[model samples]
Target: MKKVIIVGAVGGGATAASQLRYYDKEMEITVYDRDTTMSYAACGTPYVIGGVIEEESSIIMATPEQFQDKRNIDVLLEHEIIEIRRSQKQVLVRNLATGKEFTDSYDALILSPGGSAIMPEIDGMDGHVFSLRSYADMQAIQSFIAREKPSHCVVSGAGFIGLEMAENLSHLGLEVAIVHKSASILSILDEDLSKILQKELLSHGIDVYTDAVIDKINGNTLHLSNGKKLESDLVIMSIGLKPNTSLAEQAGLSIGVTGGIQTNDFMQTDDPFIYAIGDATENDDFITGDPKRVPLAVPAHRQAFIAARHITGNPIAKKGLLGTSILKVFDLDAAMTGLTETQIKEKGLLAKTVVHIGNSNAGYYPDHSKLTLKVHYNPETRQLLGAQCIGGKGVDKRIDVLATAIYGGLTIDDLQALELCYAPPFSSPKDPVNMIGYKAIE
Candidate 1:
């Protein structure tokens, strides 16, 4: 009976424990988490803040009691792993509730410490400043909104989380303004698509200020480096996320250039007995095969499966990551997978991009929506490298198709022969995806 100790019991940790139990029912598994809540939908926190979810409990997938009862695994909440003793294969744990310290020895150890929100150093950023990363963070923001009845909000950073928070905050009847440090909102997309989104933001009564940073905060006023002053009742700092790799670093594990713990295809660190996964671990990029950190939930779950299978003597090599991601912006859906053209250029890769602007479905169909699609491929080899799509409908479907194509090693010309579903209200005879493929050849 091997004893396994897992630190952090959210997405990756929870999935690993369940998958491990499924393979070997006799192994002893003990999971520890510093936060009180575990196995909750961290991605849905923004919608819950906007009253779209209605209740916090709706996002919780499982409770500690449920895991213990159903899987016969021990899940200890409010218990933090203070130190890792690699020599003895043990972890120093502290009961945050009781302030008592204990030692837990393990045959194998797993680290899934996730990540932390990057809060910049600014003067007077003491009050009403929030960053949504966990369930508690979401609760804090919701409580602040209900208590303060804030009428204006200033959101810093224009990434996925930043844009989502802006829209949700606006949904609560607040005058939302986005102040991004970059030249455009949603840096995942190119400047052309970003400009299109900026127009949509302006049309929805949201103020946009690019190439700006918050200099200082004075009570309810925010001073911008762009020489603009804004009186905001609330402030959201979604600058970025940094992987919580201090524990792994302290344990003498290698950290990759992406600031995540270095792991092999088996999610194992230099220490064969210790494994790391989730946002804290760096894996190979699916397209470029370079070290990359993907903080998305889907990749975390997949990595967990690989780690668990390896531990159970049923090893499966990881297939790498594409960093596929998507988000909703007002009436439009923005999605991307693999690398952007800018990224390709940065890597000094010779790539060609093809863009197609067409209807989501047949033009004659009622309520047909427009879609802008872009695909990048290697000009020499004709291999698909990446893709981006923005549209009112069928955006998710098309992005999924493109992501699958890239995963299957499909070439730019291969998309044209894809037999995608077509109907009057669903899609055109030659779908936007097919059009992009045809255009790529031209």
Candidate 2:
């Protein structure tokens, strides 16, 4: 029997384990994770903090027994891979609970050790400040909030997690101030599109400072480079994520320009016997075919499936990602798929973009919400490249459609004439997606 050892049994590793079992039941599969058993919806950690989710146990999707009994996969929880001996096809692991160490052999290896929150070298960062990266991270934050009961909070960084912490902290009735190094929130979005988000933040009474850098974070005070200091009760760092890649690197795996493990479409690393997937792998943008770091859940899960199939010799052809992502700020929903105009320009792609404001449903329909759709397409070929939507309702669906269109290599003409289900309460004769496609052609 072929022994396949998978490191880090979260989304990518866990999915890979199940997929491998489905393909070949007789294969020996062992999954290792430093954390607890198979957990799901780790991305929903923010919602859990905001009281949107009731319990931490709710996020867990599978237990070790379930994987063992159902899939015949051994899930070794709290077993961390400390060293990777690629030449020997073995890994040195340590049991966190007992402080015992051992080496495990594998015919095939899968690395999905995931990423961690960027903890900068600030002096007081370790003293106080939490990042909502893992289940334990969120638990610490939750305990801190409950124990400290801080009246005012400061969130550093305005990316997804930063903004999410900002909104959730504010919802907890705390005064929240966001200090961002970038010029605006959602720095990936175009300047104009970001302005819309800035206005929303202000409307929620959240103080947002752009072009601000934190020199040091002292007790309840953040020292800024702009000759200003802000006081808060607590500090939350949502700066960014650094891919967990030391294991692959020490094992002599090829690391990509993006500082992630280099992998092909099949998620196979330089060593065919070993594979890398999820946030740790260097992914390409389907539209531009350039190395991109898309650390979303869908991509992670998709990469796992791809890697599993390749290991089982049943590979599926995947064109890569369109960077599809969605976030909710209070009542507002923001989603984007494919490439943004900013990304298009960055990639030096000859692209044209159009923005239109439409109602989520019929104009006369009650509770109609405004939807702003931005579509980007190749000017020469009129091929859809990417899109972004911001609104209260139906934003997620529109982004989903755009994501599928980009995956299918659909053109603007195809998008414009596409048939979609519509109802008076749900959509219009011309869906926002088709309308954006029609406008992009103009």
Q: Which model scores highest in lDDT?
A: 1
Off by over 4 Å in 1: none
Measured with C-alpha atoms, the lDDT of residue 138 in candidate 1 is 92
Error of 2 at 421 (Å): 1.9
**lDDT (10s digit) by residue, model 1, range 124-200:** 98769999999999989988998989999999999989999999988899999999999988887988988888888
Q: Tell me the whole-model lDDT of each prediction, alpha carbons only.
A: 0.93, 0.85
Worst lDDT window (10 residues) for model 1? 196-205
TM-score of each: 0.99, 0.97
Lowest-scoring 10 consecutive residues by lDDT in candidate 2? 123-132
lDDT, residue 426, model 2: 88
Q: List, residue by residue over 58-155, the lDDT tens digit for candidate 2.
A: 89888899998888999999999999888798999999999999999999999998999897778666545777788888888899889988988888
